[model samples]
Target: MTAYILLEIRRTLRDTTFLVFGTGMPVLMYLLFTNLGGGGDHDEWKAYSMVGMAAYGALASAMAIGTGIASDKSLGWLQQLRITPLAPGRAVTGRAISGSVTVLPTILAVLLAGALGNGVRMAAWQWIALVLLLWAGALPFTLLGIGNGYRLTPQATGVVNVACLMGLAIVGGLWFPITEFPQWLRSIGEFTPAYGFAELGRSVVAEHAPAAGAPAVLAGWLLLFGGYAVFSYRRSARTA
Candidate 1:
């Protein structure tokens, strides 16, 4: 399991597309958005934007595991794994762990851009908390990715992942403040995992506990996605 987890992390790092888009894009977006707001006058907005982009970046990278898994299945790598000693469920879980691990660089890249580029400052503890919470919050998306990988063809998974990432970003207010949305839209966005995930980090920046609903929303999604991933993997196992 440890070996498999490390392999997945290394593979994710090696993917040029992931490097450019998953990790690099967030930093680029942060810089662009902050510059548009004009200089250092909006430190608060910069911090808020930093959290939003970091969350989006982490979410995108975590869900890329689905495409990787679908590609592996297409190439018969999963079949080769059957002869190994690793349990099927354990292997999938390791994939999720690895996906979460890969989210760190994306989070760091955006945070570094915020700190150096725009002077978005926080205490040392807040910096640590922000990274840890954002990384942990990506777990549900990683599980969702696992389910998609097992249930869809590589082509379909790729398309669905792109849509999912964009939809979540738009609906969950990762691209803009939820307060800017109409009341009805804000109501819907508040329930999304992406919204809750970003809020967890923002709460750190604000130096307050996250709202009670944030953890509850995330926990519910985590359980739902975990079940979906397990069922999809088992169904695929039987079919294979």
Candidate 2:
């Protein structure tokens, strides 16, 4: 299992696709927004922007990790694993672990950009809490990717992932403050995984109690995605 996880991580790192979407694009977006003076002169606003960008980076990376399962299945990696002693579910588990591992770099990049580029400041506890929450909040997307792997073709994976990710991020106010959106739009954004995830990240730096509803929302999404992944895996296993 250890060896398999290592192999998966190394393979993902080698491809560089993950790095582009996960780390580079998010950092670029952060720089672009801040360079335009998105954070403005307020420290609190800087913290808000910083947390949002970090959340965006983390979310994008997580989506990349989850959706890439389609590519792996298409490339016969699953079949290759069948000859080994890894459990049926372990393949997805390995990818989930890899996603968590890969997300660290993106988080760091966003945090540094927030601090150095945008002049945001956070205490040590705030930093730790933000990172921890972002990482934990990624579980839904990790499950989402595993579930998607079973149903989506490699050809459609890229389109689906990018569209879904961007849509959720935008609607959830990661791109802009949710407060600025129309009331109807904000209502819808509240239901998206991004809303809960990003809001949770925001709570860390803002030194507020996390949202009362975010955990429940996250739990619901995780359960739904995980159940789908299990069903899809069983069907695929039978077909194989």
Candidate 3:
């Protein structure tokens, strides 16, 4: 299991596109936005952009980790692993572990970009808490990506990933606050994982407060996706 996880990490790090999308794009967006706003001490704008960039990082991480798994499965890598001594659960565990490992660098890159370029500031403890909250808030999407990758064909998985990211970014206040959105849009945002994550990140970094109902919402979605992953894995095993 450790060997497999190490191999996965190595392959992921070697992927140039993954590095670019996972870290480069968020930093680029942060720089661009900061430049546009004159890079001032506008606390509200700083907070909003910081949270949004963190949410964007989460989305990017989900797509990379999830799609990599799906692509591997489609390429028969996972099938080969299944034929090995590793149990199905252990194999899944390795993937999750590797995903978490890959996600950390992206998270740090986003935070640093915001701090250095956008003038967002937090104490060391706050920074640690913010990282924890961001990861916690992202759990649902990560799990959803796993479930989707496990269930869908590689081509369809790509489409689903694109749709999910775009949909969430648009409706979840990453582009703008839910308050600025139409009533129906705000209603939709209220129920989304992205919204919960965005609010949680903002609360932690900007408000210096605990995430508001983020744990509950994330827990619900986590359960939902955890169930989906199990069911899909079982179905796939049976079919195979």
Candidate 4:
């Protein structure tokens, strides 16, 4: 399991495209948007944009696990793995861990952009807390990716992954504040896991306790995605 996790991490890091788009794009977006905005509270808006872009990058990184899984399945790597000692559940868990690991660079890149480029400021502990919260918050997305990998073809997985990211970003207010949305859209965004994940980090920046609903919504998604991932993995294993 440890070896597999390491291998997955290595593979993920070697994908130059993933590194560019997953980490670079978010930082670029943050820089562009922060510069363009003429806001009432500049620091607060910068911090909010920082968190949103970081969360989006993390989301892209975590969900790419599904596309990798689909590719592995197509290549019969998953079937080959069945002969190994690693349990099916552990395989999924390992992938999830690796997927989560991929989010670190994205988070850091956005943090640096916020601090150095845009003058977004926070306490030392708040920075640490924000990183940890955002990283931990990516678990549900990883599980969702795993489930999608087991269920879709590689081509379909790629398409669906991008669609999911776009939908989540738009609906969860990652591109802007939820308050800017119409009341109906705001209500819907509040319920999404993306919103919850970003809110967790935003709470640290805001120097306040997060609303209970944020963590609660995240927990609910984690449970749902986890169960789906397990079922998908086991089903794939059996069929393979």
Candidate 5:
């Protein structure tokens, strides 16, 4: 298990594209949207803008991590891997670990930008809570990607990844607040995992607790995605 996980982590580290998309792009977006605060109490501004930017970073992490499985399938690497002693479900387990590991750099980079580039600040507990929440919240996106890989081809997976990132950003209210959108759009955003995920991080700073439905919605998606991930691996193992 350790060897497999280490191998995946090493491979993930070597993915320059992953580094750029997951970390570079998110930091770039943070700089572009610092004014997202639109002038308010400094702490609140930091909280709002930081949450928005971090949400996008989280989106990138999820897409990059999830898409690799589909890419490997298209290349026949998954079949090749089966000849090894690595157990059937272990591949998926490694991928989930890789996905989580890759998300770390993106999360750290955005946090740095929020602190330095935008002067975002908070209580010690708030900082710890927000970071921990975002890190833990990223798991759902990884699972979503795994489900996608099982159902789609590599080419289609790539397209869907980009679409998911952009669509989620727009609808999840990461690029901007859902409140700024029309009532219909806002209603739509409420159902997205992006919204649920972002709102979880925001809770650390916001005066109010998250909506009761947010965690429930996230958990529901997680279960759906996790089911597919397990089923996909088992099906592929049988075929292999």
Candidate 6:
């Protein structure tokens, strides 16, 4: 398992697109938002935007990992692995483990950049909790990405990636606060995985409050997406 995970991590690191999107984009967005002065001068708003961007970065990483897995399947990687001692569960676990390991450094770099560049602050415990929450938050979306990758063609995977990113950005309060959005939008955002993640992030960095309902929402998403991944894996295995 450890060897498989290390190989996966190395593969991810060698991917140019993954490094660019997972690391570069978040840092670019953070700098843009902070420099543009659009988030307002209020410390709270700055903190909110900083944490939101970090959470968004995490989501992007999860999506990329998931889609990459799908691409791998399309390219016969999973098929080759299935003939080995590595079972489906262990394969997926390695993917998830390696994805998180690769993406996490970028997430932390974003947070640190926010702190040093934008003056966002959090206690040590809050920072730890935020990291935990971000990882937890990525799991469901990663599973969803895996399911989508397994089920969709390469071109379709690109379309779904765009749609998923836009949906999460708009509904998860990355573009704007849920409080300012329309009632219906807010209602939808409240139930979304991104919203739960954003709220948890904000709670830690901005509000200094506990993440109340985020764990449950994230867990529900994990279960839902995990089921889809399992189903897709079974169907694909049979077809293969």
For each predicted model, how many residue pairs clash, with residues at least 3 apart or on different chains? 0, 1, 0, 0, 0, 0
Worst 10 residues of 3 by lDDT: 230-239
Candidate 1 lDDT over residue span 1-240, tens digit each: 999989988987788776677788878877987797575677788898888889888998888879888888777777677568888778778889988867899999999998998888889999999999999999999899879998889989988988988888788887778999999999999999888988898899889999999999999999898888878876665544
lDDT by residue (1-240, candidate 4, tens digit) is 899999998998898887777788879987887786655456787888788888888898888779889888888787778668888778888889988867888899999999999888789999999899999999999899878998789999988888887898788887778999999999999999999998898889889999889999999999898889878876765564
Clashes of 1: 0
Would you estimate the TM-scores of all the predictions?
0.90, 0.86, 0.85, 0.90, 0.83, 0.89
Scored against the true structure, residue 227 in model 4 reaches a CA lDDT of 85
In the range 36-76, model 2's lDDT, one tens digit per residue, is 85447777777777788788777777777655677766776
Listing every candidate in turn, what is its Cα RMSD in Å to the true structure after a full C-alpha superposition?
Answer: 2.2, 2.5, 2.6, 2.2, 3.1, 2.2
lDDT of each: 0.86, 0.76, 0.73, 0.86, 0.76, 0.76
Backbone clash pairs for candidate 6 read none
- Which tens-of-lDDT digit does each residue in 1-240 have in candidate 3? 899789878887888787776777777777788677686767677766776776787676866577777777778776677677887666665666667665677777878877876677777877887777777667667777777787777778778877888897777777767899889878878877787778777776655564556667767877887677656554454346
Return whichever of 2 and 3 wins on TM-score: 2
Q: Provide the global lDDT of candidate 5 against the true structure.
A: 0.76
Regions of candidate 1 where Cα sits further than 4 Å from its true position: 37-40, 83-85, 180-185, 238-240
User: Considering summed lDDT, which 10 consecutive residues are worst modelled in model 1?
Assistant: 231-240
Instruction: Report residue 149 deviation for candidate 3 (angstroms).
Output: 1.9
Candidate 6 C-alpha lDDT tens digits along 55-109: 8888777777767777777788777877788867777666677888656866887
> Model 2: which residue pairs collide?
66-145
Residue 30 C-alpha lDDT in model 4: 78
lDDT of 2 at 127: 85
Expressed as tens digits, the lDDT of each residue in 41-120 for candidate 5 is 46667667777777668767776665678777767776777778877667666777677887777888888888887788
